[model samples]
Target: MEWIFILFLLYTLIPVWRQQRIHIARYKTIRKLESNRGSRVITLIHRQESLSFLGIPFRSFINIEDSEQILRAIRLTPDNMPIDLILHTPGGLVLASEQIAVALQKHPAKVTVFVPHYAMSGGTMICLAADEIILDENAVLGPVDPQLGRFPAASILEVIKIKELEHISDDTLIMADIARKAIQQVKTFIKQLLLPKMDEQRAEQLSEILADGRWTHDYPITGEWLKEFGLSVRFGLPKEVYLLMELYPQSPSRRPTVQYIPIPYRVENNDK
Candidate 1:
């Protein structure tokens, strides 16, 4: 019965293993493209397929755990070697994003962000830390407005401020005040992050544009729009960038849920 079970597991895992090898080869090709520059390529994408288990897909987030990967990449790369960071995410925790951004800022070598797709909210924050940002035609970056729970702090505060003079609920009053402070904090942090690359005046200006909640959380600020906003933005990504996205193509069948992945143990070689 044990042997039969082992065989069944191996049969199921064969396809998955083969796919992994193919994807790895694709990454190797991308790395080879930058070998002459002694560049390190790190992908911090929050793709549904990458984070999913089985068929269920969870929200792609740049969370605390992601810091470990960034740190490892930094450690592995020699000093002064350029790093190409591939990003495709909907954003996650502010602090987690800040940690990664700061790491990139402090990195001795040049850091460039390649966005093959959208990198919104916290993801936009990370891109700001990059020395240069490369964007595909379809890629969109969102505002850095802080989100309190599911609510956009900017929107919440706007409503509360309007209703403050009139009769307003206690909950609204409390949340509005909290939102006001949160907005200021986000604005200040963004300015600090952008300071290394730009002057204080420009940094503060860009921070206000990104975090002042002028645009809604999901607004798709395209590459052209971003350039107008005074960011160092460029269009056109390498062929390898698109090829990499193929490895984790979005599945229409994948719903937002906890992903479950199955792992198979290695079978001993009886002949040995």
Candidate 2:
């Protein structure tokens, strides 16, 4: 009985201990990056967190809490210091995103957004306000089109256009009205973020392309396309950025699909 009880305690405490160690390592890496860059480093990474008591993993996004914490970090930094935001979220609430974007836009020092993997929707919006956007060559960004509940705001408007006004339900009609406003609001905000980087004419054009219902909400916008749009985007992130990303391993709910000996290997050039 004593052995069984001891084993149960070990099982419960081991995960907690491992998690604390990961947290410590992550903070150490962030501090190292900051020391090297001489800028305030803030990370808004949202990935599959540790499994719950039920063994189910949950994901995070740019919510109010994220906004609050980031905002506080920004406030703590001096106005003259540059900000290096490492954003790896699937996007979140527009209000929170806007709050962060506006703050970044107004900062006197240069602001850079680093996307190691992907930053969708609201994440894209935040990138717009940055002086420079750094992305991994294979990473992607996403459309900033507004979503109304389960439906895209653009899709909601299309329903009204295709269906007769009388045939549309009262609920759908009400949602369509709100959707129109939401699209306009997002476009206006996007334009503001773009204006600093482009002329008024180009800002208006890019705003329409990103916020209008021209593409699906999850449409992957590559860095090449972003450059063509006249945005200051660059490919390839620093080695430290990739190192920090490894610290954020997702909690796997099932068997691992890929297996490899986790070390660097080099091919020998022995032809000589």
* Tens-digit lDDT string for candidate 1 (1-272): 99999987886787578668867887786676577446888887776553322445556688888977897888888777899988999998988898898888889889999999899999999998888999998889999898888788988887876774568888888888988898898899899887776779988888898898898899998889767757789988877777777666564463585556645579888985
TM-score of 2: 0.96
Specify the highest-lDDT model's number.
2
Residue 202 of model 1: what lDDT?
Answer: 84
Candidate 1 clashes between residue pairs 3 or more apart in a chain or in different chains: 53-260
Candidate 2 C-alpha lDDT tens digits along 103-198: 889888999999999999999999999999999998899999999989999999999999998899999999999999999999999998998899
Taking the candidates one at a time, how many backbone clashes does each contain? 1, 0
**What C-alpha lDDT values do all the predictions have?**
0.83, 0.91
Model 2 lDDT, full chain set: 0.91
